[model samples]
Target chain A: MRYEEYNLEDLFLLAKKGDGTAFEHIVRQTEKQIYNLSLSIVKSNEDAEDLTQETYLRLWRSLPDYKGESAKSYIFRIARNLSIDLIRKRNRTPGSDTVILTADGEFERDIVDHDPDIRPDEAFIRRLTIETVRECISALPPPMRELIVMRDIDGLAYHEIASILEIPEGSVKSRLFRARERLRALIIEKNIL
Target chain B: MSKHSCKKYDFMIDDYIDGLLSDDDVRKLEAHLSTCEDCRQSLRFSIALRNMTRSAALEFPVGLHERIIESVNEDKKAKNVGSKRKIFRLGAISAACMLLCLCCTAVFLMLPGNRKSESKLPPDCPMSEAATDPSAMLPSFNGSVNAPEKGEDEGYTYPVIEEPALSSPEYDENSPEDAAPTPDETCAEPEEVAPNDKNDYEYSSTDAPANPAPDVMTNNSNISDRLENAADAEKSETHPVASPEGVPSARPGGEEITLALLIVSGLLAVASFIAFLISLSSIRTHSSNKENKK
Candidate 1:
């Protein structure tokens, strides 16, 4: 039987009960998003992997106590918490940050030159758009950075993000809106469109 | 040429893109989008941004799942092995503790002749109950000084009155080998950690009362006189009269060592209990998982 067919709640229920296969299934399904979220926050490949391992390890240990809930939100909550902790370890400013991108600095370093007139195919445009959003999102403070990842990237519901972060639903809505607007302005300013 | 400004329905833009708008709200947004180029562009931007994010494949590195599962298994194995070996480990630790405690007590109890092992902390104030607990060295300020973390020179210290290194006869403040701390550095409430006295600054509490040396006494003669008087007064009034045979303020070296050993023992016992508690927690977690699996 394909692991994807199992309900997340059922998988979580089994995994918590020491079902190794269910735990494997849970990791397979959720590891991508958790790794990506960690990558977005810490901006390091190795650290992201470390964060992914930590997040899953904690989930494995903690699943026994988790009562019933959306596993996606629960997993992301653990991932987000670990990522935020990693950020704090580096001694950066807290909550939301405003990363002002300069041409020579961290935000723009990896961006390759692209001619606006040379039109690319739909596939290329989608790829380019995804990369541009990543560039823009990486420049945001951690709060907004992770908000966009949860709302737009992971497609989590507002209430899920709220429950995951333990913030008010209204706060999630506002932060997400602000994050998107900030991303839009960065896109326009950088001419990534 | 709509009746309302683009700004009027601007807030609804997020709702429109999110599909959170009611049909009436959608109608209003659509009407507003038709007239306002800015609003229309914004809507397109939101659509594109959302689509890109939604389409962004969460590309974790290859074999991440295997790594996670392996790590969890290893941790479980480690815990199981740890618990299984706990009794042996506990007995070994207890044996070592007993052996060490006995050896130390014997050495201290045997060394009644080595009583003159005086403290190097400047013969400023004669000893008090502070001998057993060094932070009580001076009463005005007390903080339990934990060892500084790696690369740190001083741990958390409550701002207590600091004796200037210059005031102490042995160390020359101006000497390149041991420069005295600046008055400001010593006086700064939060920032200054007296690096010179860091080892001796085991002040666990500041409740004991002692005269803060007058900061204004810059002349050596006056400073020396004041220090002597302070010492004399402290001895006559505060110190218990030492019976003729002993160095009298309770066994300084032996007492501190024994107290330290006791603290360490208490910490170890507490740590073992915590480990025992963690083992119990894991067992509960294991049982809960079993119940859930069934």
Candidate 2:
């Protein structure tokens, strides 16, 4: 069954009874989405794991107060807040081996058009493309990284992305389109497409 | 016109995919998409990309679900444990305080009536424990020399007697002051006169008295020896120039007991002060950490 079909109250009702099995089911069901959301912010497995745990723990504690209808959104809200907090905390610690993505207005744009289908050893090329795409995403500035992740990976609507990121919907569309165009250019330049 | 006018609908394509448009807006978007090739191609790629992303979302580490559940359980257990510990600590502190209060009450009950008055010595101190010849004075229940013995020097005069065994010459050689007759001398004598009357006698330094001063005579020779020993106690008086400063000096056994008690009390005070400082620092540090956590 789709996780979204199961309302939060059902999970919360079972969880409040000190039911570990219910908690496990909840965690297993939400773990992928939560992990992906965390990874998009922290960009590290360990940090994502930590944020996911924090998100789950918060959800567990807040289950008693949950009104049930908006449970999925509630969990997402928790995950979002936790991810942001983890990022802020990471920035505050001194001597931390932080990887900061510095944004620059002097963006070098490349426009390229490649054939939609150029099957060049599907397995190897797909692996290399995936790795290179990850590297390119890592290289992007904070704004661009977030824009690309929201639009491409999470597949959020421009309005939803804008709301999540606290930017104008117009800004979200433009940035996402630009980010995609840039990724396409990099793929062509790196000869991965 | 349909092909050329559809460019405006491209911008709303993302909103339409997200299901945010009204029914009328959806009908308009569908009417535009039915003829716009470029818009349709863009929507197809966007949909494919969205599908790929949904399909490619990474799974978490195998045991993370179980681990999260374990952590939640552990956190609750730890909270319960912490609350129990807090209650236990409060109980322990209350028990300790009660015990301490009981002990202080017991100590107060055991103390003599005049404890506060005895704590402060005279501002102008004339004597220390080292200078006082304790063996000469009578026993006192408390350490203070200002307080009189339980009985006032009941009507009596103790006489001074010379000792033949330890001649004055040999005694003077051993002690710079004139020799006091040994305990055996005055222990045998008796006196019935009051102590105040004997205080009026001009103590004669000479050995002979033709009048045979009966007022100066006491049957207890040991008591006379005690008086003569106290005669050398002029310098050790805590307050000099008093009419009867010779009273309340320590006897041999009383001096030993008071000295031991003073030493033990001093050590206890020092240890308690050190422990109090350590506990204060620990509490301060703990409170600071709590503030930082907040």
Candidate 3:
């Protein structure tokens, strides 16, 4: 049977039994989200990629002991923890706190322009390009930035984010609301709206 | 250019943008929004921000999937090698322990005390034969020799005779009949004597005079001297031989050392066996996991 057809839990169980194909499928399924989460936290594509790889490596090693929970939450939790560890280690080093704007230029170039055929008012809502949003996200505190990335960018449920971050769902909702408001203020400061 | 003035409903804007608002709350917020343009602008900015953030999804870097798989395979190979090494190490330890145990057993068997205790003497051996015929160890005489006879109330009683001084004139070293036999001659048939028997007497006809001289038999001093000499010879033979430096023949603390070695080797053998078993089980588990993967 093709491993791609298996659900996340089935893939995890097969991977725990040392099924390489199932593990690869699981990796292929989650790498994009994990990379995005890492990028949102670390603000560097290179570091984010490294963090993503390390996350999966750790997941593979720990699969034997995985208690068959939500695979997406488990994988995201690993990615989140690895990203936090990288951030902490970077904090310990001198002159490493500076945010690299490498991805901002790429984001500006890659983002599509607002379509002129649409209504002017609707186009105004699409005026905040991907680069401006990323810059605003990069400017926020780490906690708020994480909430925006997990909730808005990744579209994870409040309960799933709570499970990943090991916090209460109510805390997730409140914090997420504050994060969105904070992002809105940043967008206004950029005069993108 | 509009400043947001409706601060009370600002919190509900997020819930509204996220579509989490109830129909009643939506109606209330919509009524408030129709009269207020600032809150309307705030709601529009929140919607724009959420949309832009969702548009910011990152593409997974190319070649990362292959790298991750390679690293995992490397880790699995390293773990398999490590388990094999563990099994080999445990097996080596078990073999070494068994060898040590065998060596300890050999050494234990070679110990003087163990040898004597564990071995059985032949029935025809003098030591075995003397158990049934204790009189065979006594000197033989044609005439009635004054043998110590066992009494009902008491043990054996010998004739009370005073020992003569060696410097006395009657005691003669030159007279063949009066001369005491050498210890070697008395101890020649050591098999006939029990090591623990206190009354061991040497009785070899070849070492004794063919006929006892009349003067030697008549002399009470000579008889007492001969009996004393026999008793001294028995005592020397029964006791362990001493070294020329006066040290005892058996090693000091040899038995204790051997016993300690045996106990230690036994414990080591048991520990190594347990280690071997654990490693074997782990290897089996690892192999079974590999099989399942295949």
Candidate 4:
């Protein structure tokens, strides 16, 4: 039989005992969500990677002092802080070449290279669509960006999103719906459907 | 567009998809969705869109776990490193504040700016009566005055500069009867002060100790040199009188302004750092407090 899954309590105990493997397991599990969250905020993979790394580093460093905040809440708070810092730094030094996506999920600049004989396969198109969706999500203002991405894509509960962002649940749902409609309209405008 | 959509069902559609509505609300939404084509289609699209987005959500970059775990392990190895770095950062700010204070003090002490003008001579003022006598005053390259060696006064030159005519009418108005005596009249013979010019004699004698003899002619100095020296002495004495006024001007000048700004900023930084340390310690204590035993 396969081994039982380690819950956060078990992981917490193991991590506190200096179990690198247990901590690594936790890192592997949460890394995707934190990385994606950071990517949405910073809009750059390199910066997102740096932010994710920083968030984990802080988590491990502060783990001993952590009394009993939930894993998700702790991770998200740390990641959010790092992402916001990256966003602020990006704002100050603008004009660097930033990643841009079109409706087809292809680079807007790279679209100039016409390949008449080669057509992107379905998986490739799917990947591009996802990337384009993320790019479109990134283009929205930060307030709506995090809300829509976290609720729809990250599959966070509305209440969880509210708690993570420190907003009221009503604010989360209303804003998510409003942003969802706007995002859908944006995708439609670009003929991404 | 949803503002114009069905109120009872469309509003519930989003919550229903998230499984947030109660059973009664879900039942109402389901009943409405069966009949309302618009909301049905909207809910379907919303579900599909969410699925697509969820699939497309960012993946962990390769080696992210290894890197993060590596960093965490490194932090564990240097167990004191985190606290050490934090202390270092606090120390850095304190050191910067200290450096700023030092720099400000250096500027105040070292730079030649806005000094007490009473102690400095006017730019046009000669060092002394001997300034004209190269023999009486040896030239100094470093600008410090070297006192004359013995017998240096033997070749002293007495350059007599003409006194500037009194330009203000106050003098003439105040002394109407003491029309200046002609050069020949002044040198021809020693003359007693006419009673009308007695007040002028008293004023001049009070200011001129070298010529304090009651009769202006009785003190043996040449009339022109006496006049020039007296005028120079008056100009020199007025300087010290004006410097208290200069001190008021000095207080508002740029040197004091920079010092004030530096002092304020340094103090603010030091105070803020102290507050940070206090709060950080309190937080550490609060967080590290384990549950109280029964």
Candidate 5:
């Protein structure tokens, strides 16, 4: 059976027992989500890549002590915490912000067109390119940006986001709503339509 | 574009976008959206935002996987080396402590005060017998002039005087060239007599003859009077005398040095054993880790 078919908890248990293959499988499964979470928070490809590697290293060391119910939340929590720490350290040192870039050093050119049957204004909203959307998201306040990334970009459930953020689920919903509203306002202010 | 006047549906827009609205709420939102062009634009923006963000998930950098794996392996190797070094350091410390303890033990055993014979007194000594027998009265000296008697009502115990051995060549009986002189013939020179010497002479005066020359008696009486005055002035002070068991007389400071060394050795041995145990446990852990890797 493919390693992805194995239960995450089972994979974690095997990894705890010093199974290198199982651990690698876990890394492969969670690396994209961890990377995206890091990138969204730190906003720099290089720093995000480093944070992703660091998250895995911390996971390997702390695996034996993990008793949490969700392995996915545990991994994402590690990435989030590391990204926050890096941001705090950067804030202490003046002139530390480096140029940010996507992994391929350029934005994706082909935009996915929206269906007009659902909303009559769908084609009008599609005028805002993916790059423009990313710029708008990056311009958001850190709390709003984090909420949007975890909820919309990474597609984590509200409860999972709450668990990762150590907040109540109701707070997650309110904050996420505000983040989405802010994002929509930013896109509208861009006058792309 | 005009702002939507339907303020009541602002919160439901997100629930509707997330597919969380009930059938009834959806119908109400749809009915309101049909008349509200501004709200329809807001819904389109939310959908576009969600789509673009989801599509914007960053790709993992090429070769980062291999690098991460390599870094993990390197970290593991570094940790193993670090633990091994720690164990070696502990083992070295344990060995050094054990060596020091052995050296201290050797020095302690060689000390003069630690000799078995020197720690005890000669059995033939009268003072030793008196000291050993707690109920025994102090031995009276026949030649002690005006020896204080044991007063029944007085709680004071008289101090014991030890005679200096007359083993010098000048007093040797076997050498005719150095024949021992009679007590009267051995007149001390007035110029050579120190103030302290008078006290010694007074203590030994009881051994003298009952009838002696008037000049000698007068001189001895003068010396005895001076000695009595000095003793009275210092009556409040008591000096520590050598014990009859020869415990204090066995090489000054030797026993103390031996005891200090013994205590030091004992502490060092304990520390060394503790370090050794720590190193042994670390070794076992390291081996177990290697076994798991295998």
Candidate 6:
């Protein structure tokens, strides 16, 4: 079955029961996201794979502990924990890739020039938007960086991000609000949005 | 539009981007944004940043799953093998220690003469006679002095005690040697007078010997006598005096050969056990660290 058909809890429960197929399907689904999260923190392809695998193994074992909550939030929680651990173990600074894209680099650089699925004109706009977005996100301090990641990249709701980050909803709102405002300025300055 | 005036909009910007505003909050925020061009610009920047971060995809390489599973399996196997090695090493060490004790006991036993033979010898005899014996000598010399006269005798005679090298030589031997004069040149004058007077003194005192070598001979005879005594004690199944001073010690003093065998075996066993333990611990610690990293 496609991993999309089953929620994270369903996949977790089945995998915990030693279902190799479910385990494989779950890995197939989440591996890319987990890998990306790990890569963002660790900044190494090999280490990212190792972190993703560890995340999956933990997900498999901890599936039985799922309490019928928001599957996306729960999975993101797991991913965040595993990614943080991997980064810490490697002793790498989070968002260390910030220097590669400077403030005005967004406007000067092409964005969707790297997109796997690209149309002719949309590619240029997508590329510019993406670069501006990446640059803007990179410029944020760690608190904002994490807030945006959970809310946008991982797609968790305000409550979900707050719970995962262990902050109040008000704080989440305030933090996200600042993060977005900063992004909008960067977009305007870069003229990509 | 002033930079100082933008502070009020700064705090609310993150919440606005996250869509956390209620209907009234949104209306108020929108109303503020509509009137404030600077706030509007700030809101747009926040939106762009969120969109960019969300869209960035961190890609994983191929075959990560199989590699991770393989690593875990290998680790578990290594741990299992390592534990068995540790157990084996521990067993070997205990066996070795016991064997070493046994061998030492046997070595002490097999030397039937021990200190009893020395007591039989003349008190004037320097302790270096054992090193001077021809059979115990090896061509690969360590520049050790074998002869010690009375003058040099104080520090030199018990070279075994002084040198440390002579006592526990690379080789082991137990044989008797000739008694020579002490290095004190002045003692040569007294030496001529002392032996004659010593014989008379011994005859008058011990009432056992009229001959010159009788004391030396008597000492050899006592070794056999002590051996016999040890045997009798063993026959009686009582603890025998192993020391020449008649201090009571471990039982079975006469069977040195048997004790030596036990000691060698015990020592070998102990060495193997210790090596095994070190190897196992190293492996375990290595694997445990690997597991932690994974």
Query: Chain B TM per candidate, please?
Result: 0.30, 0.33, 0.53, 0.30, 0.49, 0.34
User: Model 6, stretches more than 4 Å misplaced?
Assistant: A1-4, A65-70, A94-129, A135-143, A178-193, B1-19, B59-294
lDDT of 2 by residue, B171-212 (tens): 444443534334443232212223334344555647324334
Q: Considering summed lDDT, which 10 consecutive residues are worst modelled in model 2 chain A?
A: A93-102
Ranking of candidates on DockQ, top first: 3, 5, 4, 1, 6, 2
Residue B197 in candidate 2, Cα distance off native in Å: 32
Better of 2 and 4 by TM-score: 4
Q: Which residue pairs of candidate 4 clash? A: none
- Backbone clash numbers for all candidates listed: 10, 19, 0, 0, 0, 34
In model 1, where do residues sit more than 4 Å from their true spots? A1-3, A93-128, B1-4, B56-58, B86-294
User: Which residue pairs collide, candidate 5?
Assistant: none
What range of 10 consecutive residues in model 4 chain A has the weakest lDDT sum? A110-119
| TM-score to native of every candidate shown | 0.50, 0.44, 0.64, 0.48, 0.59, 0.41
lDDT of candidates 1 onward, in order: 0.64, 0.55, 0.67, 0.59, 0.65, 0.54
After superposition of all CA atoms, the RMSD between model 1 and the true structure is 29.9
Tens digits of lDDT, candidate 1, B1-294: 442465466568878877898999899889877776666655665677778777764566888778888899998899677775784576566666666666666666566544444442234423333333333222221222333344342434333333444324344523544433233333221112343343443333462244232232222233344444544444444444445565555555766777578567656766665665676676678768768758
Write candidate 3's Cα lDDT for B92-119 as tens digits: 8888888888888898888765554321
Which scores greater on TM-score, model 1 or model 5?
Answer: 5
Candidates' RMSD to native = 29.9, 16.5, 12.5, 19.2, 13.6, 19.6
For candidate 6, lDDT tens digit of each residue in B112-194?
53423333223453322222232222212232333433444243221111121223334223321222233442121111211
Candidate 3 lDDT by residue in tens digits, A40-78: 788888999899889988999999889989888999999
lDDT of 2 at B2: 47
Predictions ranked by TM-score, top down? 3, 5, 1, 4, 2, 6
Task: Report the lDDT tens digits of candidate 2 across residue range A1-193.
Answer: 5434655557666676555556667776667777877777677888888888888888777776766544445666688778778878776331222334325332344324333333223333344435556665655544455566666676555666655655577766766655654554454456543
* Candidate that scores best on TM-score: 3
Q: In order, what DockQ does each candidate have?
A: 0.26, 0.22, 0.41, 0.28, 0.36, 0.24
- Indicate the docking level reached by candidate 5: acceptable
Off by over 4 Å in 3: A1-6, A92-123, B1-8, B16-41, B116-252, B288-293
TM-score of chain A of each: 0.77, 0.61, 0.80, 0.73, 0.81, 0.65
